[model samples]
Target: SIKEKPSSKAEKEDENPGTVRILLLGAAESGKTTLLSQIRMLYKQTFTESELIHRRAYVYNHIVSSMKAILAFASANDLQLSLDNQQRAKEILSIEECLGPFTQQEYDAIENLWKDPAVQEAYKKRGNFNLNDSAK
Candidate 1:
């Protein structure tokens, strides 16, 4: 016999005409954004141009943060990057949130760090810690 899942608040809301509330909670990189995107698609929602622009900046910032996490993991585990890649890792760690999108230099730094063998090894072990999906 198959088990029936209990109905939750969302199902209860369908009986009346009112706002629906949902909360997503999970560890980092656990697909919260993916779930939200699915929900939006289910509702036939679309992002406005301004929202798209803001989301672009978000993607840039997430890339930087993901690199920082990988670099930190490499350092903590005593993995050594090449001198130039070490410099790139330092630059990525010190980067602030992107207001718009990443500049060319910033983007290159992340790409270089990501190509480092140390970073790649760290990425392989990312499941031991919280690293963003963008790092993949």
Candidate 2:
């Protein structure tokens, strides 16, 4: 673990200061968040339950959004879903953004859609569109 150094005004006046600052820059899923989480752990900065809950909600929301994007791409590219999964895709797209965390049925629908060949094809070209890191 890296420890923070305590410095006085006199230290600030010194040729070399004790304080160090780091700047992180990256695109999505490029490990920026992972690095920050590791740094927070090293500094004993634990996330609360409420924060974890919010992260869970974020994951759920990401699933919904990713599915929607994949479905739209499939439609635009003439990728056809199976008869069963076509209905599932429609249900996924119809989901309201603020409907909250997914229910079991909704989760099942998402899982099934994810397994669809048409959705998988669109997912392969996910880089062409803007999707969440969690979507991967």
Model 1 per-residue lDDT tens digits across residues 42-134: 999997899788878777777777787888788899999999987777777878776676778887887787788898899999998788656
lDDT of 1: 0.81
Model 2 accuracy (lDDT, Cα): 0.80
Q: Which ten residues in a row have the lowest lDDT in candidate 2?
A: 10-19
RMSD of each: 8.7, 7.2
lDDT of 2 by residue, 1-136 (tens): 9965647765555535654557899976688767987998998989999878876776777778888888888899899999999888888888777336777888888888888898888899888777665686
Q: Candidate 1, 87: how far from true, in Å?
A: 1.4
Instruction: Tell me the deviation in Å of residue 83 in model 2.
Output: 1.4
* Model 2 vs. true fold: TM: 0.69
Per-model TM-score on C-alpha atoms: 0.73, 0.69
TM-score of 1: 0.73
